[model samples]
Target: MAKQAKAKLDRKGLGSLGLEKLIDILLDEAAANKALKARLQTALAGEMGPDEMARLIDKRLDAIDQSTARINKARARDMAVEFSALARNILSELGAVDPQAGAERILRFLGLRFPISARLVADSARLWKVFDDTETAAQELIQSVDAEEQVLLVPHLERLRLRDRYGEHTGFLLGLTSVLAAPGAHAWRDALMAVLADEPMKFGALDLAQRLSLRLADIDAFLSLEKRKPENRRDTLTVAALLAEAGRFDQALEWVRERPRGMRLIPVNGSLTSVGPEYGAHERRMLEAEILERLKRREDAQELRWREFSETLNPEVLKLYLSKLDDFAEFEEMDRAFAIAAEHEDIYLALDFFISWPRLDLAARLVERHNHDWEGRYYDDLAPAAEALSAKEPRAAVLLYRALVEDILRRGIGMAYPQAGRYVGELARLMPELPDGHGLSTHAAFLAELRRNHSKKYGFWSSVPGGMQG
Candidate 1:
């Protein structure tokens, strides 16, 4: 093996070289020695001027070619961490000197080197903070970069926007709006429109675009672009929302009306009736109701909402409609709705309504009345109802708990053993609380029945708590 020559460059000696030459020397040294590479980055950060620091940063960033920056999980992650910090330091230094220019450089770098360096910068809090900080200069950055260059940044910008709650970054949104508003910003528009045209549209992107359109008061432009593309259920819904928000109630009504009507199959005797449209009609109708209210026809809106709620039993729509009413009217109507819910053929909906209303008493009645036909998910509704009813009505509660336990054991659902055993423990506790002459079986009798029928289920037996293990 050939011996490599000793690399010697004094810390003081680095000052003799030009900024570019110093970067070259550092890159050469760091490439040879990983520890020195790591050391020089921090040591030079404080030692160098902002311009020199930017030069160092730019050199380092450029040097991270496909060969150097290629993701290797086997390599220590500390390298990526170090590089990310360097990128942030460079950006901040550049930003301090020239916020607009720095933002342009950052966007350009992100656009050009995203694929290779995305993982390197992924989750870099400092870089994201720089992005957040420079948001105010976002428009200047957009204008500085060419249309093609700005196109490269669309994805990163979108990512930054989506990272925020409701994509509300003011500066980042300004840049997006500029691109969307620009006559030549087709690449930007296409990127957003592509997301909209996705089989399942990207809700975040759609929301950001809508917000931008709203800011620009460009609903017609957005609708025009959407019309050029294939129709989607989500698009229709979005257009309806945008139009409604713009106080274009007549236009909003048209979008809602355009939705395939009656898409939901009406359940007639436990089977779906084929005559109606069903997939997304409920939401469309809800939008129509909202448009009615916006159009100053409050009575029409209320009646439409009430009819939809009665027909579909949609909790969300009901909640929206109720929110507009006074508390007294809301509760009174809720009481009326509660009565109607009890008779719903979909007993689960009735059960859900009672539970949501937190009317445990009414829920118990419904469960007891329809116990035989109750084919609801055990863990979801049954177990929860059992726990709720246990405090007030031990006999009724026992029936629900026993039903859950039996169902689990009958199905031999091993995953549910721990839960079933806990239910058994609840039954054990509740047995002592039973009133005299309660019609339900005693705890001992119930345990005997469980043992006789499910003695082979070792999974259930082993999970029974210490005292309850009969």
Candidate 2:
């Protein structure tokens, strides 16, 4: 039977045989001879057809990609060294199949680490060494790795930036900048410049690029590249903002003023009757205000910001206005601002602003007017406000303190115990001075409520000195 099979097999060429049949024959032969099995594996590694190698490599890469939990910097350097060998071997096989696609796949793997891989790269300088070694290996596999790889590898730059910012190691950031700025590294430089152009020059890139000996001209040139693109040109405000950040205030204002304006008709009594400059009017005005501030045109800046603040009661705008003036003047300004905040339809914002300002007189009045609105939030603000008012307005202060103590016990929040306990002690001291007809619960009744509701809170009991718990 073996002879007949052999004779029939001999009638057909090995290439003509079905792949499964050929594999079965090889397996049978290999099972009978260990040496042949080893030889077959070696041949598959070296002499396997491109299609077969690609399929095996794709399967292997899929496994590596799926087993993401194992990839991180905390792994020993030896492990990274081993993986470098494995990645190189895989890429070498892949390159034989299709160099460009193999390069893309490899770049993609490094490009998107998914989750904590960037963390891994960022956490240690040793891992950066591994990364450098891997880069060298990748270059060997992909002769002349292209500009796209630089784009793909940008997260490394970001990680380095973070490390540099947080004062991890100066050498690493400087070394990286130097390497990226090295001769024949135009792609790296361009990729970095492109990524950074989207971010503010003041925030990061300006200093880092300058560290690498990159001038403002190079940065401006890169920035203009994005501006030249049709899609990016639509957002002229961004370029204007960048120019402002670069201290070209006049140019920035010019760009801001030059934004294309379109006229739009307003609905008046359901008929289109009014025409106004529509596109970017609000944005342009805001930019102009910011530019005027930068130019030290304080009056113009204040006018624009105050107008916006009056219409919106935006606390940030108010803060910006206040920062330019003295602290003594801020209270007066805050009084005016808080009056507007009080009128705002959102009572929560009013309450929050009053309490945060510790405008206790205003807050006490607000709380008294809307006592039922208290739902146990903002005790941090309320507790302190109550304490501040205790000196002169013990009646109002007692009301707030009692409210805070009740809210704390009702909600079972523990962190407020120390502050609440201290306030309770102060309330006990103020009991003698509190007038009878002050319209607040009696000190005896407040003590009864506290013991009734929170007898079990030993932390609170311990914080309050004597028999006040009764």
Candidate achieving the largest TM-score: 1
Which residue ranges in model 2 land beyond 4 Å of their true spot? Answer: 1-215, 225-240, 247-288, 292-300, 307-335, 345-364, 390-396, 414-420, 433-436, 451-468
The CA-based lDDT of model 1 is what? 0.64
**Which residue pairs clash within candidate 1?**
262-277, 263-277, 263-278, 264-277, 264-278
RMSD of 2: 17.2
What TM-score, over all chains together, does every model reach? 0.65, 0.45
RMSD of every prediction: 10.4, 17.2
Instruction: TM-score for candidate 2, please give it.
Output: 0.45
Global Cα lDDT for candidate 2: 0.59
Model 2 lDDT per residue over 1-470, tens place? 46553435364667678799888999998886543553455348557565565555555446655565554544635445444544555466566555555554554434323332433534545544555555555555444444345444445455545444433333333344544424324444555566664764322453344334433245465455434443322345655777887799987887776654454332233222334455555667778889998888978988887787766555677888788776698889877887787676765566556665556677667667766655546765566666677785676666676777678767777887776677778778877787667766677798787888778887777777575444
Candidate 1 residue 138 Cα shift, in angstroms, is 9.5
Give all candidates' CA lDDT scores: 0.64, 0.59
